[model samples]
Target: MLLKTFGWSFAVTAIGLVAAVFYGGWTGFGVVAILSILEISLSFDNAVVNAGILKKMNAFWQKIFLTVGVLIAVFGMRLVFPVVIVAISAQLNPIDAVDLALTDKDQYQQYVTDAHPAIAAFGGMFLLMIFLDFIFEDRDIKWLAWLERPLAKLGKVDMLSVCIALIVLLISSMTFAAHAHQHGGTHVDKAETVLLAGIAGLITYLAVGGLSSYFEDKLEEEEEREHEAEEQAKRSGKQQSAVLLAGKAAFFMFLYLEVLDASFSFDGVIGAFAITNDIVLMALGLGIGAMYVRSLTVYLVRQGTLDDYVYLEHGAHYAIGALAVILLVTIQYEINEVITGLVGVVLIAASFWSSVRRNKRLAEAEGSTEGSGKAEVSSGV
Candidate 1:
């Protein structure tokens, strides 16, 4: 399983590197590959969190994710998003902004940097709310009688979550609007940009996130119905067949994975400004980031590693929450992209090590139980 996962990832990486080499030679290819690996390492938690969500999606959506979804991720978010950011924040025509990016690489880099404050404010605060909501939200799974009622009640109506999001949006808008006015002066109206960005973020949160959640719930209901049908078939002494077809299953997982990938890519897409903004480099670096994220998702699923590392998901969500806070703070203060990535890596690494120790202890306990059972059997004989 490990070999297959590694082999597939290596092949994908090689393809991406080759494309980069053709576009910008060995130097460009090397840079992108390294950056991609770094992005992937920093985003392991993203894959785990995605898997938790993907498990709830329907099969058809998952297929859309693996195919068209990849296009959106590799191109839409990575290539187009930065350009869009620059165009909107700088008050330039989108075409002109993109042309500048393709033609005058240095100026384009500056534009992206100039635009980063707003991007960070919008995407950062939005992501922060997601993390905090997930963390503080009660998610207790109950099988008993009385315990299930309160746990179910806690699950409904995320009031605190809505309040936190509103606060982040208010703070982020005020700060970015002020920063934009300070830097761009007359060229860009800070208040207008901040207002637009805050609106954009709110819309994205409601549209993308709300839709994804709705679809996910619908899929879960369908899956439950199917499971019930399978149970009935079994009780009737009929042949037990696989109710969830592989293609269908793969499609749903793929779709949810793609949306999840897009959500996570918002930071890297925005952060690419810190590096050289040559459309080529942004595409290369961010593409590598996307590729690695895809590979990591597949690796996690194939390995069932999340099952072993119980706290891995928790850690990743926590890191997401931290990144969101850092992003929001950067609206007023400059937070380095490298630092953001490192914080996530450190947290995830700690969680992974914790999982490893936990598994080792479980194994030892099982071994001790088997040994005692063997001794008892011999004495009885």
Candidate 2:
């Protein structure tokens, strides 16, 4: 089952390895392999959260996500996006950015790193909003009741999550880049950069999420009408097959997912610099890992893994929260990719085990209830 599902992913990964070799011989292949591993580790939580949203989409959208989405993720974000960033940040043209990347690797990394504070602020705030909205929303099943229960209570406040995010952003702007916060001091202009970038991220999230919701609502209404039509056709002894077209709603959702993926990629792209700064190798390796993540997303949706592992979504959101904070924190200091990856794995693993235990307990309770019911009937007789 696993092999058939992930066959394409494995094949793409192999192709990535071959591409890496062509780029820099065996050493390039090894670098690609390591970067791929790093990307997969860092973005595992991204795949989980992606599945949560992907399952709600229709089959056509789902396929698009795995296919068209891969192109956007790999080429657009992994390859082109960094170059675009460097170009804009350094006031260089696209050609110049690529030239610098190829000819002066250290200068390229420096330019990219120099843009890190803005990147972190934008990506971090967007991610934090996602985490915050999830935690504040009311859910029947609480994964970590000890923590979630209290958080859920606070959800009653109007725009509470956004307020919290704003507060955090304010604190980070003042503290993370202390010099920039000083009165009329220009040692570093990080405070304004963080503030503006974070606001941009927050606004993007709101716009994308709101528009997607509106479109999805319309799609739902259309589906309901189609379902009614199908029932009428059945009553009239006519066969009807409802064709699920890729409508505006799905298109908006596609946009939403892509933006979400781009936000997630910021950390991974920056982190890849720690492994190797060779633009070609980094692109190949990260692209391969991205393909696998997309494939994994489809597998999860098809297998209904999220439905089975109920608390898995909770864990992913928590990991995203941690990653957001880490991104903001790293604007001033450095953090190891290994540590970031490990934290996500641990949270997801813990959630998986908790879900299993809950399922087992529920099964046992049902069994006990059934056995007692049988005894009661016999006694009544």
Using lDDT as the measure, the top candidate is 2
TM-score quality measure for candidate 2: 0.77
Per-residue lDDT of model 2, residues 155-189, tens digit only: 98999989999999999899885543222222365
Q: Model 2: residues >4 Å from true position, as ranges? A: 14-65, 179-189, 231-285, 301-305, 367-381
C-alpha local distance difference test of each model: 0.63, 0.76
lDDT tens digits by residue: candidate 1, 170-272: 7666665565423333333355555566567656766667666765665566567667767887899786555454344455555555566666676565444
Report the backbone clash tally of model 1: 7
* Candidate 1 off by > 4 Å: 1-4, 11-38, 41-68, 139-157, 172-192, 224-261, 267-279, 300-305, 372-381
Which one is best on TM-score? 2
RMSD to truth, every model: 6.1, 5.0
In model 1, pairs of residues that clash are 58-252, 59-252, 61-255, 62-251, 62-252, 62-255, 63-251
**Model 1: lDDT of residue 15:** 77
Model 1 misses residue 134 by how many Å?
1.9
